[model samples]
Target: MKRKKVQFGVMLHGPGGHMNAWRSADVPSDASTNFEHYLSVTKRAEAAGFSFVFVADGLYINEKSIPHFLSRFEPLTILAALAPMTSRIGLVGTISTSYSEPFTVARQLASIDKMSGGRAGWNVVTSPLEGSADNFSKDKHPEHSLRYDIAEEHLEVVQGLWDSWEDDAFVRDAGNNQYFDKDKMHELNYEGDFFQVKGPLNIDRSNQGQPIIFQAGASKKGSGFAAKHADAVFTNGGTLKQAKDAYKDMKQKAVEAGRNGDDIKIFPVLSPIVGKTREAVRERYKEIQNLVTVEEALAYLGRYFDHHDFSQYDLDAPFPELGDIGKNSFQSTTDEIKRRAKEDDLTLREVALQETTRETPFMGTYEEVAETIITWIDEGAADGFVLTPHVLGELYDDFLNEVIPILVEKGYYDTAYETDTLRGELGLKFKENRYTQKIRV
Candidate 1:
C-alpha cells in the first residue's frame, strides 16, 4: 500500500465516552440532547482541521446501557441537521443494515451528501444486540454470519440506487424547457435475497456521485464485507504489533477482493489522556477512573456479552467461564477481554476495572501524545485515527489546542481546509456513476 498523509476523525459521545462522564461538573447536564453543544463542538473540530466528526448509534437500549447510549440523537437525522451548519467537515453516521431498508437508508444518506456538497459517509453496521430485533418487531435477530449476508445485499442495493442517475443527467434549461436528460436515467431493478429495490431513486446524485462507505469489521465475516465494499474501516487499536497485524490482514483482504490495498484506509480508535504535565495526566486519569464503581464496570463489560449479569460472579475469583456468550455481539472485543483476563490471571474485580478504564497508549504531555500518534501511522500500524474524546469538552479542547499544532509542525497534519468534500479531504477519488460508465464504454 502506498503511504498517505494521516487523517483524523473525532468520535462524539455527547458528555463523554466514559461511563461516569455525566457526573463531572465540567459537562453540561443536558449535553447529549443539546443541539447548541453539538454545534459548538463540530465548529471547533472543523476549525482545527480534523477530517470528520462521527456519530455512533444503536437502535435498542436497556436500563443497563451506558449513559451516552441511553439518550442520544439518531445518527442520520443529526448528520443531516449538521450538514448545512458546517461547510468543510465530513459527517459520518452509523445505520444498521439489519433493521433499516436499503431504499430509505440510501435516500437519507444521499440527501445528506447533496446537502453537504458530498461530505457524507455511512458506517454500515449489523445491529449486534439481540434485543434490537425485538424493537424492530422481528422474532429473532439474524445470527452473526447471516447478518453479514444481509449486510452484503443491503449495501449492494444502496450503492446500486446511488448510481440511478448519471453525472450530467440534470440539464436545467428554461429556454429549451429541458429539466433533465432522459437517456441518463437508469433503473437499478435489483432483486436480492434480502432486498428487491426497483427503478431509479427519486433524488439525483451528489457532487462526489456516492457517499463514502465505512464499516467496522472485527470478525471474519464482517471484515470480508468491509474488504469488498467499505472505502474506510473504523477499528479498535490494541497494541502496535496487534494493530500492525490487523492492518496487514485488512489490506491483504482488500487486495484479494480486487481492490487496491490503499483503497480501504484503516483507522483505529485513538483515545488518549493528555495533560500539561505527566503528574497532571496521572492525577486526571486516576480522578476519572474513580468515578466508575465496581458495579458500573461490571455493567459496562456485560454490554458486550449480550448483557450477561457479571454481578453474580465473586469479585476475587477468576473470570467466569462463558463459552460463546459474546460470539454474536462484538466478537473480537469479547474474545480479547477473555483472553487477556485468563493470560494475566486477573480476578473478576481486576478485569472489570481494567476493562472499564482500559489503559490508553497515549498518556502524558500533549507532545508525547502527538509523538505516539505519528509513530503508529508511520509504523504501518494505522493509516489514521478515530479520535475519541474520552472526557468530552476537556480532552477534546486540549487535543485541538495543544497536540494538533505539534502534529501540524511535524508534517503529520495540516490546519487548512482545501477541499469541500470528505472524499477529497481523505484523498479518495470520486465514484463515477455506473450508468455513466456504461455510456462511455
Candidate 2:
C-alpha cells in the first residue's frame, strides 16, 4: 500500500453528532445506549481503515441533554468493551480531568492499552459545563483557568504513574522464584497543587508506552495546554484560515515548549452531509433542519451561551449585547457565536437555527466533500479530519463508500492501515518513560 498521508478519526456522539439525528429514519432512537449500535459503527470504520473511534463523555445531563447526552455509555467502559472486538483501529475515550482522579484514569487507560494490543488513546478534556461540579460535590464548576490548572496537574500525575515501572520491570523468572526486578520500580512521589499521588502504578507501562493523548481545546489556555502535552489535537477551527492559523500556532507552541512541532497532529472536526447529487444533498440537509423545532433550537443555543435560556429572549430580535467573558460554559464558543451574530446582524432565532443545522465539510455531493477535506489536508490546514457522522447508519456508510473512493483514487488515502497503534498510525513518537530517559542519559 502507498504511504498514508492523512490521519482520520471518527467520533460517534451516541446516535449521531446532530441534535435531530435520532429522529432521522436511518437511525434507531434508542441507539444512544445500545451496544450493538456502537459496535457496528466501529466495526464499519475499521473495515474502511479509519484511524480511531472516539467515545465522548460528559458528567452533567439535564432536560436539554440531546439524544446522545441524555443517556450514553461512559467513554472508558464503551472503549473497553470495544477493545477486544476490534483489532486495528484505535480506541480513544474522552475523559474529563475536573471530576476524575488521575490514578483511576491512568489504570483504566493502561488496561485498555493492554486489552487492545496497544491501540488505545486518551482524549483529555476539562469539563466546563456549569452544573458538572454538582455531580462531584461542588457548588460550581471550577473557573476556566483553574480547571486547566487541575487538568495539567491531573495529567502530570497520570503520566508519572504510567512511568512508575520501567519496560524491563517485570521478569517473571520462575526458576529462582523471582517475579520482577525491584530496582526497575520507580515511585512517582508526585506532589502538585491539585494532587499528591505517592507511588508506582499497579500495572506496568503499556505496549505503546503511555496512551496517546488527544485533546480538543479551542480557547487560548486550552490550545496552549494541548500544544504543551497532547500527542494529537481534535482542533476546532471554524474556517480554513482559522484552521491553518490554529495549526501553525499549535506547532510553534510545541517547538517553543522544546518538543518537535510536527509530533502534535491537528485534526479539524468534519461533518459531511453528502448525497449522490447536489440537489439531494440540499434536500437531505433541509430535512435534518426541519426535524429541529424552534423550541429545541432555542434550548440548544441556551446550552452554548452559558445556559442563559434563549427562550427568555426575543427570537427574531438581535442577540442581547452580552459582552464576552461572563459565562461559565465554553468561552470560545460563546465568543464565536457572539462575533458571528454581530457581524452578520443575525437575529437570535437565526443564530440559534443556524447552529441547529450544524453542517461542516459543507453539504454537497460526495465528491465535493472529499475535495474539501483533501484541500484542507494538502494546504496544511489540518493533518486530517476528525469525522463526526451526523446520523450514523447510512450517513457513515455513504461517506465510507463514496468520499473515501475519491480520496483513494486521488492518491490522498492509503489502501491499507500502516500500524496497529494509534501513535504509529499518526506518526507520533512513543512517549519516553522519565526514569528510562534518565538511565539512558
Candidate 3:
C-alpha cells in the first residue's frame, strides 16, 4: 500500500507569491508573461511528484498591481495549454463566479477537465477586484453578502450544467442506429434568487465526473459557503496553534452542514524559505527584501486595504486605525492586517515591509522547517499545505530538493504520485450529479 502522506500543492500567483520577488534579479522580470519559463516550473513540479499546480487570477488592475498582476496569462487558457505538456499532475485555475455566466464558465472548465484527463480543478472565486464592476458595465460591485449569495447560486448552476449528461450518456452504436442515450440526458431548468439557467450542457463529464471545486474564503459567509460546497479550502495561518484552530473550525462547520468533515481538505498557505542553517536562511531572505523599496511596499498594502490608502499615513506611526474595510474587497486579508497590527504593536512601515527571518514562521534551517510542517499536519492544524515560493525558479527548486526530502524521511510526505485524478490525489470524492434525479424521472 502507498504510504499515508501529507498533501502539498504549488501556488503560482504571477511570477511568484512574494510581491517583492519580482524585483529580485534571480527571477527574470518578464517571467509573468513567459510561458516557456512557466512550463519549466510545471515540469519540475510534476517531475517531483507534487500533487497539483494552481494559478490565481484577477480581472482588474491599477497602479498597485506590482509586476505579476499588471500582466499575465489568463488562468483557464494557460492551464489548457499546460495540459498537453504533462500527464497525471493536476491543473487548477481561478475564475470569478461574480463576473462570469455560469453556463459559459461551466463549458470552459469542463473543456479543461477533458483536456487534462480528470486532472482539472477550479478555484471558485466570488469577488473579482476593487474596480472590476466598471469593466463589466456596472457602476458598483455587489456588496459582500450579495456577492456570496450570487456565488451560492453560481455554483449550483455550474455543477448542474456539468450534470447535463450522465456518466453513460454517450454511446456510438452503428448497428442499433444510436449515438447517445436520450433517457440518460438531463436538463437543468434552474431558477435561483440570483440567476436563471436552462442548461443541458454542451459537454460531457470528464474523467473525474466534474472538475474538483476549490475555494479560498476566510470571512463568515465565505467560510460557510466553502464548508457547504468546496472540496478544499486554501487559507493562511501564521502559527501552528492558529492553523490547528482553523482546521478544526472548518471541519466542524462542514460536519454541521451535514457533510463528512474528511471530505473537505484544509490547505494552509505557506511560503517556505529554507537553508542549511539559520544564518543562510536569513541572508537569502534579506536579499529578496532589499529589492523592494519602502514606497513600493506601502503601495502593495493598497491591494488589501481597499477602503483606505495606507500611503497617506505616517510610516513611522502605529499602523493607522481603520474602520471595517474590505467588505467588498479582500475581507480576510484586511482582517489579518488588523489582527497582526494589534498583536505585534507594529508600525505602518513594519506592517508594509514584512520580511522573513529566523523568528518568522516558515523561515529556518531544513530541520526546523520540516518539523513545523509535520507538526501542523499531526496537530490537525492543516491537512496539507499550498506552498508559495518567494522566487519561482531557485527558491522553488531549493524547497523541492532540500525540504521535501526531509519531510518524506520523517514520514509526513509522499515519495510519488499515489493516484491519477486530482480528486483522488487530494483525497476528495467525485462530485455526485445533481441532475441524476431529473434523468431518473
Best by TM-score: 1
Q: Which of the numbered candidates is closest to the native, going by highest lDDT?
A: 1
Clash total of candidate 1: 0
- The digit string of per-residue lDDT tens for model 2 on 1-441 reads 653377788986877888878888888888888899889999988988889998888788889867568878888889999998998999999999999999999999999998887888999999868788888898878988889999999999999999988998899999999898999998888888899999788998776888999998878899889989999998765788888988888899999888998888888888888999988998888887897999999888877765667787888899788865335577778888898989999998999888878656557898888888878887789888888877887878999999898889988887488877878888877778889899799
Extract clashing residue pairs from model 1: none
For each candidate, the alpha-carbon lDDT, in order, equals 0.88, 0.85, 0.83
Tens digits of lDDT, candidate 1, 113-207: 99999999999999889999999889998999999999999999999999888888889997999999998888898988878889688898888
Model 3 agreement with the true structure over 99-154: per-residue lDDT tens digits: 99999999999998898888999999987366889889877988888888999999
Sort order, lDDT high to low: 1, 2, 3
The alpha-carbon deviation from the true structure for residue 132 of candidate 3, after best TM-score superposition, in angstroms, is 0.6
Q: TM-scores of all models? A: 0.98, 0.97, 0.96
Question: Which pairs of residues have clashing backbones in candidate 2?
Answer: none
lDDT head-to-head 1 vs 3, winner: 1
